[model samples]
Target: MPTPSEFFDPSFIAILKLFLAMLLGGIIGTERAVFARQAAGTRTFGLVAMGACLFIVTGNYVDVAYLGVLSFDPLRVAAAIIMGIGFLGGGLIIFRGDSLHGVTTAAGLWIVAGIGMAVGFGLYLIAIFATFLTLLMFTGMWFVEDRFKHWFEEVKGDSR
Candidate 1:
């Protein structure tokens, strides 16, 4: 008659988890949006993360009985994620003779998936912390790389 199982029920908690995935992904994505200068920005990353999380959560349901009986292999969802991630990462990588583009975006998407996965499993704390760390690493890497480049140039000049 009514809801059979809380897991089966479309509860606010489930929706909230999905929302959290988007927000956490966006938090890290903001940097990618403006700075990485990729076609896929804040909206893209946010949407991908939330969409993946929903896919995982819904995959866990999916009325599996249609095939034979209702059963889910969370690992299947994880495997799908990994396969899709490889494609996304490849999308971000472009060879331009001697330089590359979209590597940052690729890495960002990769990290965002972990955040999304954490949210899917209802690990809110991990999701939050991961979001923060992702941002820190994303922002920090540029400065560190730039400084290292300058140092290398200076050392070369001294050697000359």
Candidate 2:
């Protein structure tokens, strides 16, 4: 068995962060798949989160200082990730007739990217809490919205 220090090694920690990001994203994706029945389900969300985390982790380890390069802003990579996610999210959205669809799924993806970024930056608590809140919004808000729609339908029926 490896020593305890091995677990705390930077490389090990980085891998751990990636797995955590994937797991968290998978949790959100599970809800979308099983409950919402979205096309972009567990694999899609997990891959997105893992990809974002990979970019962040790679940026962190680029070693520009050793290459005698100055003014390397890591946030640039983050901004690029955001822009990329925006493109992907945009693709998910569809406008048909008088209504739009996939907005929630796109938003879920956007937030999952943020969650991965957070995990990649070593903010475990924030990432986990954000994941919790995302799930809550997904499942809980769905329940609330369903109830509200039912109630509205009932009121409309009464009026008719």
Listed in order, each prediction's TM-score against the native is: 0.84, 0.88
Question: Taking the tens digit of each residue's C-alpha lDDT, what string does model 2 give over 1-160?
Answer: 8954365877788798899999999999999999999999999999889888988888887854345575567789899999999999999999999999999999999999999999888888999999999999999999999999999999999998
Best-matching candidate per lDDT: 2
Candidate 1: deviation at residue 35, Å?
A: 2.5
Clashes of each: 0, 0
Model 1 misplaced regions, further than 4 Å: 1-10, 62-68
Q: Lowest lDDT 10-mer window, candidate 1?
A: 2-11
Q: Tell me the lDDT of candidate 2.
A: 0.90
lDDT of 1 by residue, 36-124 (tens): 66687788788778977887777765644345565667768867886787798888799999998888788888878878877877777
**Which candidate wins on TM-score?**
2
Error of 2 at 49 (Å): 0.7
Q: What is the lDDT of residue 65 in candidate 2?
A: 39
